[model samples]
Target: MIATNEKLLLDALPQPVISIGSNRHVTYANFAAQEFFGSSLNVLRRQHIVDVLPFGSPVISLVERCLDNSLSFNEYGIDLTPPTQIGGTNNGRMVDLHVTPTEHEEGNRQALIVVQPRSIANHIDRQLTHRGAARSVSAMSAMLAHEIKNPLSGIKGAAQLLEGDAGPDGVELTRLICSETERITGLVDQFEQFTETHADINSPVNVHAVLE
Candidate 1:
């Protein structure tokens, strides 16, 4: 926990604030910091900074640099996406990072980090990507639907004609062909759903239920 006055000040700021120990473990995380990392303060406190940041993140290096030289650094457009995934409906956030050396009671190097979230940039990027994918899906669905349905119509008509002229067993086979073509046509129709629009929101989620 942070000291009373310091905690109040940090929590009041819109940007995330974190206090990291010499060992790279979190000492304190303000309210916004929890939301920034997609984690709780308790989880952040237990884990090393490297555990939360993406692999090869520049932020990690900056933290180390600040600790080693007792210097302050201000960086822009830093990506804070999780290692497992990057940028399509992202589970992570982006920010402008600020790191500075801080004093510790044990005379060890520590760091104070501030995160200025740039989530709007990610939102615009995600929307553009979604639109591009939707267009591609729509175009492919139209082309394949046009090409296959034309052939299917001919096949079904041919099958119907054969059913009239053939023996009982042959008629059953023709009917089966007609049924299969209809089923395939139905499958192709489903592709159109991808082009439909939907709302994008950060709805409240049941975390415990998901874990269970």
Candidate 2:
């Protein structure tokens, strides 16, 4: 009765779960397992687990180790082929699988396998690439601002001093100097806005909408 209840509980898990017998036959597969492998549970029942999974897959080797030593095996990077009709772009995806020995009423050696897809590492990699590009652009803008700002300020100040000494002779040149300085200052202000706008803001936002 306990073994039967265990089987029911195993089948109830949301993640893909399977039970393999000593003969390496798939004794049980949950609904999620059927969907993930793109086959019905009835079709997989009594079939060898290796028949569905590639022979060279890490998951296959892990299951073999668990059955051989009667010990549990936990591994990441198990690659399994999705059925062609499922529209999977990649040949396979990375997953974490755990296998543990379980005792049955019939005294047959069996193992329980639980599977979870790996996603967090890929997400982190994408975010890091985006931030690296943003940082490079910010650094270049800052360098340009620093290189041009000081020389423009000196030219404007010298023009003002010359105007004070030249009476009416250099009024037009002084006015031109002030206008050019203001134009350069406006450009510098625009660059400053870019650096300021991206300053470590932490606000909750719908990421999907932001991406769109």
Candidate 3:
């Protein structure tokens, strides 16, 4: 029977870990490993290291090397695909493997392997980068809207004031100025909406209409 303290410690770990005997058979698999492999301890203990891992995987070679050399090895960004599934679900994952060899009670070498998946890590990195870029764009758009739109409002008001006193040609010129200013301000409003973080759900735009 495993000591309470030892079992508790192993189960408390966040990452999956397994120990391989000299025969490359699994001697011990932690709670995380059972969850990762989708198997119980009894089931996992009956299987060999090769059974859980994909056939002809480099990790097997690394395990052998570690056991033979009595040294530790770390491999990063290893793409792993399990050979079999416990409940008809299996997906490939990127992981970092750490192998450490230790002496057993009978003087044989047992290798410990830690499996750390990188999918969650990669996702968090992408999310952070995306949010950072969004914030930067939003700040730039807000600054432009404040600086340009304020002066643009004054120009639009002056053009409207000139429209009544101007002659036909001057009236046309003022009208042109007012129309152009309105168009520019409309563009600035769109930019402001684009920069808003909590924007309303936008309707799908037609690519053909936009292009035309």
Candidate 4:
């Protein structure tokens, strides 16, 4: 049995971890591994490494090789699709694998496998960046509208005040000033749309219909 402190430390790690015993049995799994495999530690301990992963999986080979060679290694971009028996999805789960060979206090050879899932992590990062950029655009549009509209208002008022003092020749110049300010104001108001959000509508349609 794993000591309480050791188990706690393993559980605290964010990445999934599984320990394979010399007999190729799953000896231990951390909390992250439990969640990743969709099984409790007790359930996993009853199964062998091949039972957990597919037969002839790279992970199986890595663990066996680690035990045989007594060496640690890293493998990238391996897809260990969760077993169908568990509540895992059918989608490909790409992960970077790290295998470390070690001898414990009991003088037994053990292999540690830590799984770092890539696809989901990268997807979440991309989403966060996209949302952050959208928020920045909205804030910039709002700031620009505030700065431009205030000056435009002052200029429009000044033009109206000047219209009375001017003669016929200069009256048209005042009118042109007012009209140009109004046009620019309308353009600035259009920027307000960026601050508002609209729901996206999605539906599937036939490609042949579009081609026709």
Off-target runs (Cα >4 Å) in candidate 3 are 1-5, 86-89, 121-212
By lDDT, the better pick of 2 and 4 is 4
Provide the lDDT at 123 for model 2.
48
Q: Which candidate should be chosen as best, given TM-score against the real structure?
A: 1
Q: Residue 47's C-alpha lDDT in candidate 2?
A: 76
Ranking of candidates on TM-score, top first: 1, 4, 3, 2
- Tell me the spans in candidate 1 whose CA falls farther than 4 Å from its real position: 83-88, 119-212
Model 2 error, position 39 (Å)? 1.0
Write down the worst ten-residue block by lDDT for model 4. 83-92
**TM-score per candidate, chains pooled:** 0.55, 0.52, 0.53, 0.54
| Model 4 ranges off by over 4 Å | 85-90, 121-212
User: Better model by TM-score, 1 or 2?
Assistant: 1
Error of 3 at 166 (Å): 78
Whole-model lDDT for model 2 versus the true structure?
A: 0.76
| Deviation from native of the Cα of residue 159 in model 1, angstroms | 37
Candidate 4 residue pairs in clash (backbone atoms < 3 Å): none
lDDT of model 1 at position 13: 91
Question: lDDT score, residue 149, model 3?
Answer: 87
lDDT of 3 by residue, 88-197 (tens): 44454668889999784578888888899787877578569888998999998889888998998899899889998999999999989989988998898887887865
* lDDT scores of the candidates, listed in order: 0.81, 0.76, 0.83, 0.84
Give the distance in Å from residue 166's predicted Cα in candidate 1 to where it truly belongs. Answer: 45
lDDT tens digits, residues 1-212, model 4?
A: 45689789999999999999999999999999988887899999999887889646788888888999998989987767666543445445668889999787888999999899887776568569888999988888888888999999999899999999999978899999999999999988876766744234589999999999
